[model samples]
Target: MIISAPSASEVRMSVNKSLSSRIAFIVSLLIVSVAWSGAWAAGWSPAAPMLGPRSLHSATRLANGNVLVAGGFYITTVWNFPTAAEQYNPSTNTWTSAGTLLRGRRAHTATLLQDGRVLVTGGESTTSTLAQAELYNPATNSWTEVAPMISPRAFHTAVRLQNGKVLVAGGAPVNSATNAAELYDPATNTWTAVPSMSSARKQHSAALLGDGRVLVAGGYSATTPFWSSAEVYNPATNSWSSVGSMSTARVLFPLVVLPSGKVLAVGGNSGAGLPPSVDAFDPATNTWAPVAPMGIGRYVHTATVLANGQVLAAGAYGRDSAELYAPATNTWTSAGVMSSTRGEHTATLLANGKVLVTGGSGGSGHLATADLYSPDVGSDLGSALGSGLVQADTCAATNDSTPACSAGSTAPDRSFTWTAPSSGTFTVSTTGSSFDTVLSLFDANTGAALGCNDDVSASTFQSSVAVTLTAGRQLRIVVDGYRTRCGTLTLNIQ
Candidate 1:
């Protein structure tokens, strides 16, 4: 948990100023986890239990670094159910009961509004699907009923749009699949009917693209089919149109938008049944490509994008397993496993640079256990923090000395070193403000280009480059600028 840094003279001005204080904070936070066994295998461990089990629920990160977990069934009794809510605090590794919902439900959706409130809508209760909607205020830890959707739904998808309104789409209404879509405005706390989808689907995946439209894909349909067809919703016009479909149709798994602007469809059930294969879709081209397959076949698992640009997938039913995907090489590598086997569990990426994976259907049944995924850290791993950006030239004190790169720009370049893995492939993922930044991977001992994002196709940032690590090897990552918002990288072994 100790993160030692170079001597003060060797540190960047930005990193040195608050270095001691930040180090102390990170170290302190690291010690908060008391149950560190199986939790560590999942890369990190969860610090505390929320008031309830949250399978098939939704958790949204708020602007303040707190996560709002809402609306999922609580297995209170075989004959009764509990409608509850909670919030997780990373700084304290604890959970506090947030509030009670209007209805006891599961498979609902929650979206964090730009104003910092959470809007929760629709899920199935023991008795029926619900059309009720409510808003939770983190500051007050309370909930207020909002306008309900036109359709009672469970297993729907809700995404916040750039325009500031939330979009709720297809799921089961009452007992059948639905093609309906609705929009919720926090400004007025009202719901408006929108153009219905071309398909009736439940358990489908939806993502807001960079262009401000919603990309809707794969889910189960009543026609005895799992759909591969996909569509896009134009918020400006309140309409939907067919887009490219996934290579394979899946439901109850995960589809995440990568930092690179490509959508990754991973680990889900095809109509044929659950499949372990992962695929990537490029909206620019509306095409799909086969990438790596997950080490474990999982349906009902969770996928989260880390700040460093790697996607972490955890918790399938029988398996207490998890894995990381590096889009750079279109490959998958096993990650540290979770403490408990979970399906239909919730995994959320908290604002504090750690992922909080919580409550789900453990193999034995509903579970209250939770865990976290801490990116593996090592000297080599630290070296990866600098990849994917441009660097300026450096001037030495004398002509005989090697010139160094210039310091302090909006996108300050990065540099790091890591010993190569003995028998596995390794990758470095990056995040920075420069939209078109460049990445270069170099042998740490000798500055040689091993591979790079620039060497790949255009528009590749938030990417990874795969190379086999020798018994003991090191690599350096460099960004050509400074002053960027996000400029971190993660090293992965697959």
Candidate 2:
């Protein structure tokens, strides 16, 4: 069932049923206020670097579970762009060079087609922006050129639509920018002009939302020097509408469509250089708000959403550092550093639950070294109480010396008693809007973490945290370190 939007009653019901356990958790307030202190404060180790080292490139996933990385400048030349291509096999954790492009290029866009091929569009060679387009067939491992675009352009926005057509929008044709837009039909291998944007832009970012609309935000405008203005494109109506402007004016930024159906605009350069700014836009309200900021300023970077609903914003033209964003808390955390400092590289999420980052300019020049980011199983929530569990007066009348559960302590947590469902192979679970907390199942006879292990790769925020418990017996439930004081959590058994 497609739910375009749900009413307020639906939202409240979800909150109540979902957070029943958390509401029962009685603790203090110290833990809730200190939750955000962990943002980018910790760094995870990267999996491994890819084979080659080429920067200013693009990478796309194939239907067959492999990734295609192609074209970028190499070495430190005035612009020694290479047409070389490579394919990565996630199953084997290896990379094999594939067919190269007919022409060397950089800063191009690659759109994955429905028929299992990828359409490579315009980019700059050593001299000028390209109008040409090409197609790559994974079956034969080759590239074939199609008809050129009506206008020569590079750094333009290209999107694959529901009808199997690709829409190419505004960018520079010469040294100057243009508002022109075009459509490409793979069925005919031809290009046709669509409605031009209200403003001309380049180095902007575009994202397709769940409701079949594309939100285009931030880039340089020909009229203004640079822009923070944003707009939405309705492919069904073939029209554009001004949405909202960003908190800061930036170009060469990255846009990610979150699981919640909201759009997040990450770091970018402020015309003269890069800036450390992160903002989110809600299409439902047509507004933007500041979220967490990145640790470092970045432009020409890549922001990729993982299967687990976390976003990995990695690689930028100037820096090698990367960060992960958790929508559950609207915060950013450092996810470890890359093998090399890269800018203009491509980060592609593989089907095997790993992200493949390939090719970009590593300070020295264009590079080909690739890296993979694998998410950890997550750790236990420990003994810390998370933010936002209903803190009722556990000792309203009798206990006045200590902070009551209702008033909450600087750090508060919820305690609950559970009768084990059965004896064999039982586990605890939760459904709430908090952290990825650690769940521990204890013997009613014993009050220790499961197996006496403190780190269980799961952290509780608002949802239920469960560990396997001995069946037929009683167990204790405790949630540590919630994401927010305002967030809710529910505990249960499964």
Indicate which candidate wins on lDDT.
1
Q: Locate the minimum summed-lDDT window of 10 residues in model 1.
A: 394-403
State the displacement of the C-alpha of residue 181, model 1, in Å, after optimal TM-score superposition: 1.0
RMSD of every prediction = 13.3, 15.1
Scored by TM-score, the top model is 1
- The runs of at least 3 residues in candidate 2 whose Cα sits more than 4 Å from the true structure, single-residue gaps closed, are 1-52, 379-494
Candidate 1 whole-model C-alpha lDDT, 0 to 1 = 0.69
- Per-candidate local distance difference test: 0.69, 0.67
Question: lDDT (0-100) at residue 469 of candidate 1?
Answer: 70
Per-residue alpha-carbon lDDT of candidate 1 for residues 1-494, written as tens digits (9 for 90 to 100): 33344346433554423455435434443453333222112254555776755677777777777777776654554633456777776655677787877776788888888988888888888877889988888888888888888889888899999989999999976557989898888888888999899999998899998888898888877884688888999988879989877778888877899998988888788978678888887878877787888886788888999767888988778778888887777677888778888888888876544688877888667777888777653233432222221222211111211113222333434454665546467655433222223455777778877766521222222334678777667777553321232322322323
- Clash number for candidate 2: 58
Model 1 spans with C-alpha error above 4 angstroms: 1-42, 76-80, 377-494
RMSD of model 1 against the true structure? 13.3
Model 2: per-residue Cα lDDT at residue 294 = 84
